[model samples]
Target chain A: MFKLIKQLTSLVAVIAVLFAFTTESMAAKKSKTLKNTQKKGFVRCGVSQGLPGFSNADAAGNWTGVDVDVCRAVAAAVLGDANKVKFTPLSAKERFTALTSGEIDILSRNTTWTLSRDADIGLTFVGVNFYDGQGFMVRKSSGITSTSQFKDGTSACTNIGTTTELNMRDFFNSKGISYEPVAFEKADEVVAAYDAGRCDTYTTDKSGLAAQRTKLSNPDDHIVLPETISKEPLGPVVRQGDSVWEDIVRWSLNVMIEAEEYGVNSANADAMKTSENPAIKRLVGAEGELGAAFGLDNEWSLRIIKQVGNYGESYKRNIADTGILPDRGPNELWTKGGILYVPPAR
Target chain B: MNFKLNKIIPQLVTLLVVVLIFGFFAFNAQINMDNRGIEFGFGFLTQESSFDVQFSLIDYDGSHSYARAYLVGLLNTLLVAFIGIIISTILGVIVGIARLSPNYLIERTAAVYVEFFRNVPLLLQIFFWYFAALRALPLPQDSEPILGFSYLTIKGLYTPSFVWENLNIFFYSIIAAIISIVVIKNYAKKLQENQGKQLPVFSISIGLLIILPLLTFLTGGVSLDFEIPVLKQLSTTGFIYEGGLSIPPELIALTLALSLYTATFIAECVRAGIQGISKGQKEAAASIGLTPNQILKLVIMPQALRIIIPPTTNQYLNLTKNSSLAAAIAYPDLVLVFAGTALMQTGRAIEIVSITMLTYLSISLSISLLMNWYNKKIAIKEK
Candidate 1:
């Protein structure tokens, strides 16, 4: 009788546990992250540790840059205030894990969108904000202008757990030049190692090279080679299984780009709400129900534009005026003979 | 019978509850992963890694599989641990003995070293060694070779590579010499026990070891040559030593920091072990007219080892685990390559992290088992 009692209780416990899990697994209709962010009254954003023109924080801990503008745009659209954002600075290795593990609602770091990261790693890349390419930086004293002067046994310094490692290998192998890769976990460490003359060249994204070059002891000593090794379309990322939150972030960035195309600055965003053109009016929340699809108010896009400004304004404030990259180059809009294009906000 | 049933029933209930909780969590993870469209599998191990490592012991390239990359990382980790344990043991024994020396300066220095290195965090020390100390080394262009054949620069220590001819024959000769020395030592031990004779076995073993390996070079088809490193210029100012064994500064810094930090604790363990022995035991050995060296070797050391082995084994294990800090300095150890880079690339966080944890557990257990065996061997025999 005692043995039978034990057996019966164990069987009952197992079935009850199964029921609990099965009930919880019936895929959520609404985004848990969105609900959590709303309850907390802030959007949890993950950005880079410190990239100058991407998502760098000032001495007062106020984050600014194009990537920061993405999360700020989201905060304006969702939370109704641009400053209602908590930024979690992440390393290259910890960025995706931070997003997928629910540590952050939106990872607006300058993370490259690759197939494996999007399709395999439980992450969804909404859209590209920065189109970058891997490039090499050599010391000006090395007297090497192009990558063709790179010889066998040349050591290269780069950050670990980044697409730069893979691209570096591809570049060196294609050129049949045997090279050494000294990969560190932090960007600052790579710069320090390269500045210490431990490596013959430093390799990362072209923009990164341009930004980090200023940090060297003598900024005039290094020169970036004229070689773009791989295509790196860096963008914001969100966790999988939350399409609604992903669409909200996606449209937030798209609205910024579209606003830039429509010549709507933050100063004129309110005036543009009464513009003559329908497309311009829709961007400022005057002509359409575009906000309804995202479960937001009609003023969401307008708030983003008026508070966070358009993409061009963000680029000028953070990247160009800061002297990281003076030219607009490929980051300029499609109508201005650049590749920054987005689907029209209809 | 009733009492046994009463005890067993509660224990069984507790065990069942624990098992059910564990099962629920495992099931929850599976379901959550399923909903997120993240596949859980180790099939990526066989896929092409498509990544390169800076310093590897084995022949590895980006063309190799991820498993091969994993092996390279494991080997580098083991290499650091092996070198650290050996160096820390030697340093610890000397410093332990020095701390008790009659010389005031030597004892004070030893005391200061143990307190300073042990109290500072190992990570800070690692950073100091790599970022501060190693960075101060000269660049390859301006480097001066220390031994006319080896260059120690910011990049690494490039030494002359050994080019051996018929290495197998040379190894066989050395093996033959070791076998004979062991056989002779056994005979000498029995002769001492049965016939009260003491042969000079140590001298004989040394003679055989030298003659056998030397004889291999004379006639057994063994020849050795050194491939000296030559400075090669990448650009006008960039230079590197090629055609030799280049040990990266990462390995040197990590090994130096691990051994130095771990040696301090090991030195304390040794000091405690030596001091724990009673003074009467040494006085009694002196009364028996035994020499001081014999008293130390045959009497004091045997007892002190029983105290030292266990704690020293702990320090060894700590050194092995702490070698994972090589990730910070980019030594490509098991953590940096397998957990840091591989996990980031594959995004199989659960699988990769679990495998890494299990690997560290296995390495630790194996070290523990080996130490336990040695402890048992040197333990005081009881009737």
Candidate 2:
């Protein structure tokens, strides 16, 4: 009986080990299939929660944003359904790992593409979604105007797992200044610290600075610095190995820029299906198999436009209409003296 | 032959099954890590960390290697554990004695303390102290000095950082006092055994301990000084304290929770140790012409320690392990600095996580080994 019992226990252990291995293998296989299906060819997009003017869910929980349009336009060119894409809202720390792990097809979470993150972490940055910089917000009574004027030994409030933290340290260090840092893991904590007078200044992205300022008890009392110390080129990121997935993500962003340039929006998209221009005709898939190379049909771009709208349409509704408008700045298209340029659809 | 075969075959089969299971996991882990391009290695320990820790017991910067960072984290963890153990021991003994007190109010008050702190989770207690409790403090500039030496501010508790001069001479004096105590204890034991004479060994040991350290200060050039924090303003509004050591609120909260939580268990152990001895033993000692103090010193303590040491050691071990929760409050403990941040940067999840888990396991195992030896030494000698 003892012998039989020992045999049974060992058998259970072996079965448990086999179960774990098979489950892991099955999970890997499923992910591979998901990747192939996305590339053959649908837009696998990731987005954020209601961060008004950047990315947010509507009353129905449908994502709309300057960042979201980048994904939708790619879907239009690839899958023929801009609504065919999947959006996943990610926390600050989860964003990078999600992209690297292939858990999300693409990350467009206002994530800054840094040199070390790009080169060392093995991720590909297709294009910039927003060009921002780090700034500090302080109470008006603090009498701190420029970041340079802020002396050493002041406790500055900041968030963890963001380039804004590194920028704050490097900027202060370069100026031969030393400050006691008070870091928190969330935006709410940083806001609370600043509001409670626990910190001399709260530093983050310029857009984040604006958002956090609104949450303060006296929004008018806080002033953000104008000297943008670091270049935070926020954009979408993808895994390193898959070229097919990378191309799909890159073109999705380009399609949005191209649509904005061509004046093709959700309202005019159906009319564009009968346009005279060969470029528009081909893009609308009224003519050729340009998308089939991406493992998608020719009507893919049209569907994307119909579902999510053009870049200009998305930007205006998501960011500009609310309060922050792209004033012919870096976000404007190349035709209007901006840097947003797209590769021609051959 | 058949009976022997039954035993041999089953043992062989069990061994084969255990080996097979291990082999399967080893095989899959190899393949899975290879497919993901993650190589398992401890080489990251020597690589530049490029991360800054907020609180450290030792000097550290991003320029330091990951190994140094681990040391910083390990040392900080030990520091908190040591402080928590000392505080809990004192609090636990007092509360445990009070719980058995004749006075109704004192007993009730001790019971209330034990019940209130014991029920709450250590993490919540830490958060309450750090976020809600510490946040209510005055700013550095407005902070009133405590005892004219320390400043209690929202940033942290800034106390006078000690500057020791000729510390080695002072340490030698402590060692000398300890050696004399051992000699005196042995002499007293011999006097009690061979002759019917008794010596005041405890008082002599106490006098030696104080007098030796004092002698070093007077003649051996041993000195100590306090670096008090002074408030300084850089700008019109911004102010900070400098020159003194600042203990971050995270450490304060973590230690506070660990001590208060562990004290309840330690109190139970203390009460059990005291209550364990029958009333008959006290009466018997009195009948044998022993004084009350002598009965406590020679009989009760030796007996109570036998009961107390085991549970108290367990509490110390629990406190050490629970210190890992310091990660939640960003206390730069072993879990936060080494496991969380270092693993993210290096992408060496398997290696780093295993090392950290093994470190904690070894600490626990070694303590258990010492406990076993101590238990064996104190066991009753009987035929």
Identify the leading candidate in terms of lDDT: 1
- List model 2 lDDT by residue over B236-319, tens digit each: 766778887988877888899999999999998988998898888888999999998888776776677779879888998999
Question: Estimated TM-score per prediction?
Answer: 0.95, 0.85
Task: Point out where model 1 deviates above 4 Å.
Answer: A1-29
Residue pairs clashing, model 2: A74-A252, A76-A300, A76-A301, A76-A304, A77-A301, A80-A300
Q: Tens-digit lDDT track for model 1 on B230-309?
A: 98888989999998788999999999999999999989988998899999999999999889888988888899999999
Instruction: Tell me how candidate 1 scores on lDDT.
Output: 0.91
Output the number of the TM-score-best candidate.
Answer: 1
Computed on C-alphas against the true complex, the DockQ of each candidate is 0.60, 0.22
- Model 2 residue A41 lDDT? 61
